[model samples]
Target: MYRIQEDHLDINQLTQALTESSSECGAIVTFVGRVRGSSEKNRSVKEIYLESYLSMTNKAMMEITEEVQLRWSAVEKISIVHRIGVIGLCEPIVFVGVSSKHRKDSFEAASFIMDQLKISVPLWKKENIEEQGWVWVSAKPSDKQAALRWRL
Candidate 1:
């Protein structure tokens, strides 16, 4: 499942849904990403405005989920939920959940999904800084490097 919403994310609901998706799964791993107060640009972030090319972003997320299952055959289901619009500091921005027959597969699949989302998804973010005002966030080299580690 892939979702892009303008409301706050319900982490519990997402995890619960994934847990009930399959009876064969023994392990479920989830990753929750939140907006931080301080960023690498040394700006004090007040809020963040997120937007996405909805159709394309959702497509990419689905593709990433499919890739996870292809790489980890034990993975039963994957769910990704990303929040758009203005989000306050310390609020959840995204969620990735994976269910598998074992802990290793679940953990690895969740991690891979998150890394790929960061680099491949068409989501854009604007930071409302305390002093500098709203500024568009740029891609980080570290994020690209992380995604590169998963090359087939």
Candidate 2:
């Protein structure tokens, strides 16, 4: 399952939902991404504003989830929830969870989902700096490389 919402993420609830449905799986890998307090350039960040076209974002997330299943057949379940709008520093922004019979598949699938989302999703981020003001965040080369590594 995947969702794009503006409300704050509840990590515990999301984890429970993902694990409860996959009791047969032995491994559950989860990742929670939070808003950083500082920018890549080491500047103080007050908050982050995220925006997305809901329909397009949902479609992209579904495609990514499907690809994960195709690549890792052992995966029993997957969950991805991303929050948009203004988020305070250190607030949870995204969650990715994967359950499988083994640790390897669960970990790899979770990582792949997050890497793909970073590059393929249509979400935009604007950082609110403490002193400099708001600045549109650009994609990083490292993120692109990470996603490319998963390609066949």
Candidate 3:
């Protein structure tokens, strides 16, 4: 399951829901992304704004889920919730949860989903730097390199 919302993300709720169905699920892994007070390139930030291409983002997320399932056949469930709109510093931005029969599959799948999301999702972010004001956030070279690790 995947959701793109403008409200705050309830990470615990999403994770609980992901593992609710399967009794065979022995491991559950979750990744939560949050807005930071500062980045290497930006400091004195107050808040951030996120804008997403809704339909396109959802499609991309679904594709990522499908790919994860293919790569980790033991992965039983996947839940991804990404928040948009104005997000305060330290607020949750995204959540990715995976349930599987073993820890290894769940861990790897959760990491893969998050890495793919950073690059593949159509989300545009603007940082509200205190002195710099709102500046558009671009894709980082590090993010691309991280995503490249999953190429199949």
| Every model's TM-score | 0.96, 0.97, 0.96
- The 10-residue segment of model 1 with minimum total lDDT is 15-24
Please write out the lDDT profile of model 3 over residues 1-152, one tens digit for every residue.
99999888987788779878588999999888898999667487789999998999999999999999899999999999999999998999999899999999999999899899989999999999987799998899899999998884
Question: What's model 3's overall lDDT?
Answer: 0.90
For residue 105, what is the lDDT in candidate 2? Answer: 95
> Model 2: clashing residue pairs?
none
Off by over 4 Å in 2: none
TM-score of 2: 0.97
Task: Return the number of clashes found in candidate 3.
Answer: 0
For model 3, the run of ten residues with the poorest summed lDDT: 39-48
Winner of 2 and 3 under TM-score = 2
Q: Regarding TM-score, does 1 or 2 come out ahead?
A: 2
Candidate 1 lDDT by residue in tens digits, 63-145 = 99778878999998888999999999999999999888999999998889889999999999899999789999899999999
lDDT tens string, model 2, 1-152?
99999998989998887777555688999999998999998989999999999999999999999999999988998999999999999999999999898899999999999999999999999999997999999999999999999986
> How big is the positional error of residue 95 in model 3, measured in Å on the Cα after superposition?
0.5
Best by TM-score: 2
TM-score of 3: 0.96
- Model 2: per-residue Cα lDDT at residue 102: 88
Q: Pick the candidate with the highest lDDT.
A: 2
User: Which pairs, if any, clash in model 1?
Assistant: none
- Residue 33 alpha-carbon offset, candidate 1, angstroms: 0.5
